[model samples]
Target chain A: MTMNKLQKSERFSVVKKILIIITSLFAGFATGVFGGGGGMIIVPILTGLYGLQQTKAHATAIATIFPLCLVSVIFYLTHGGWEWKSGLVVTAGVVVGGIVGALAMKKIPAKWLQPIFYILMIVGGIKMLAQ
Target chain B: MQYLWYIIAGLIGGVIGGMGMGGGTLLIPILTIFLGVEQVEAQLTNLISFLPMAIVAVIIHAKNKRIDFKAMLWVSVPALVTACVGAYFAPRVKSEWLSKGFGAFLTLLGVAMIIKIIVQKIKSKRRANK
Candidate 1:
């Protein structure tokens, strides 16, 4: 009898282990620097390393960012960096934009998305270099 | 072995981000190309990672009295709200289009930055000559 492919418990186990390692390192250090790139890394890692579906990877990435942002926000607040009014506005916009972006992501083709994302990276990089 | 790479990446990312240069620029490319991660995943990772860095920067700026609560409030509230909206809608949208749109945004931002820098340099030179 062919081993039940769905019952391949080893796959899930491996995925879990990889996820834990990636999440911890990506979230932890990236948080410390107050930067992004972890999101970029997470999705790819989830799909490549953990073999998750692209959609699932994307969802997971979004979920992970929430807590990370929350913690950073808290840290800023404690440091008296919480600009209530501005934070509120940006947060508002981000929340709205984020939702829209997320919704849009589901329908987009990965192939099309990749080039655009890459272009964005190059442009963003050039901008930084200029600065 | 990987820990070393992680530390290095983090350090570089931190310095660039702390300087307000946008770590996503570096992180995204590296993740996609070097790390062999998918583009969407890399972008998501960058977005998620940015939260903490942004928050920290905000805090540092606040401590330095450079936060400009008034300005920050204006910028952040809208940003936050939109971010949520974006996130909520992300699942439904086409990733390819989103990627293209995001790329256009980045390119525009880059061009703007370049122009700004050039203008600043020119103005500084004029002032020095005067």
Candidate 2:
């Protein structure tokens, strides 16, 4: 990339930054409120508005959600809503599944992934709402 | 066969989690709605399960240079703070209301995405014509 183009791309607009932070905050809030789904929101903002590549956006969204998840977990533990045994079992699945999924990211094209994500979100949202 | 479900659930959730889409969204519903786990327990399980997956995915992404650490830092601070606040306020809301609202939000996003696709197609078609 040319220096001018690189600089232009890297330059963070104040408006954009604020928008990102605000969205991030809301995503975090959603995670806390729903105890999940923050990444759903974060990934979109990163990919759509922040202009991150799809793969990077997916990875970054996970990274961004880490701290928020930790915070909420603390509350879940203290506030008396956890089932450790079941959580342990699920954790085992996620650990293995997560690694595989991350590797799988390389195989999928961005065009396909975005729609898959949207479909998952729509399906998940509907299921939760119906329940 | 009974414990198989947990492993299967974890594996699926882990894969999705690694994809950065939040496995809990998938895992929780599967556990609660299908597997007969209680809602709160399912939610908590999702949270715990994501921890290790997140760590693994992030580390891999980091090595691949896929993560923008600067943006991660910028988003994390407020997210961390608000997450706590959201958790604090969560108990006040009725579970039914919460589910309904979350459901509505997801549907809205889905609709928005379809609109986005249409808009982009129109813009490209215009460009092509010129």
Candidate 3:
């Protein structure tokens, strides 16, 4: 999905590009295997490795995850996976909430994003491990 | 009626996810922990559900001119290949072990992120003091 040439003319060396690819491999597989966390991996790569700003990085993350998640959904659906009774309900709510949340991002201060995110990661991590 | 909780679960997870924090990260755990779903099933739900939410979010972001399709290609092409491999193998793994492995991954990443935040905060404070 090539969009208009990136607004800026910045480019990365082959080595850096390769690093992006390798890390994406991790992001892609994580989403496929775990069914989530691709965005977490992808966003850091955009912001840290690629040096995109917060909003752009989040946008690009969705762009990247859209395709990655599509691949996983295909495989999961094909392989004896039809648990959508509850899944549909959740998906429906996610769509409505997603719209508002995406809108809300622009209003939020980026300075606070990292601290909040790290806290979320720690909390989610402990919960998963505890279970 | 019974699904009301599920709806609420999705809503909370979606909002955070929309903020670009990885919806499935929270969503899968929510399903597994609070709603009593199996680990694998929760993962599957997260994956399937993500498709629609991402589409919606992407469109909204696109309209806002937020997405970098160039980056999308750079990262996604290679990721697409391995995603197939991972997806192919995921179902074959034992669910409990898989959950535990993912749990460890989250915990490690969490610890690392917190450490990074602390260091950043300290660095800023030191700069302020100077």
Q: Which candidate comes out best when scored by TM-score?
A: 3
Give per-residue lDDT, candidate 1, residue B104. 45
| Candidate achieving higher DockQ, 1 or 3 | 3
> TM-score of candidate 2 restricted to chain B?
0.71
Q: How does model 1 fare in lDDT?
A: 0.45
Model 2 has a DockQ score of 0.62
Return the TM-score for each candidate structure: 0.46, 0.80, 0.84
DockQ per candidate: 0.05, 0.62, 0.61
Clash counts per candidate, in order, are: 89, 8, 0
lDDT pick, better of 1 and 3: 3
Candidate 3 docking category?
A: medium
Deviation in angstroms for A107 in model 3? 5.2
Off by over 4 Å in 2: A1-12, A108-117, B113-130
Local distance difference test scores for all models: 0.45, 0.76, 0.78
Between candidates 2 and 3, the one scoring higher on TM-score is: 3
What tens digits encode model 3's per-residue C-alpha lDDT throughout B30-108? 7777888887788888887788776766788899999888888988988899888887777778887777767877766
Q: Encode model 3's per-residue lDDT on A14-131: one tens digit a residue.
A: 5678799999998888878887787777888898777789789988888887777777878877876667788899888887777777788789844577567666656766777676
Candidate 2 local lDDT, B1-130, one digit each (tens): 6568888988877776666555677776677656777655666688777777677767877999999887788778888889998877665566677667767766676667767777888999999999
The residue-by-residue lDDT of candidate 2 on A15-102, one tens digit each, is 7788888998888888887778888788878887677987788788888988888888788777775667767877887887877886
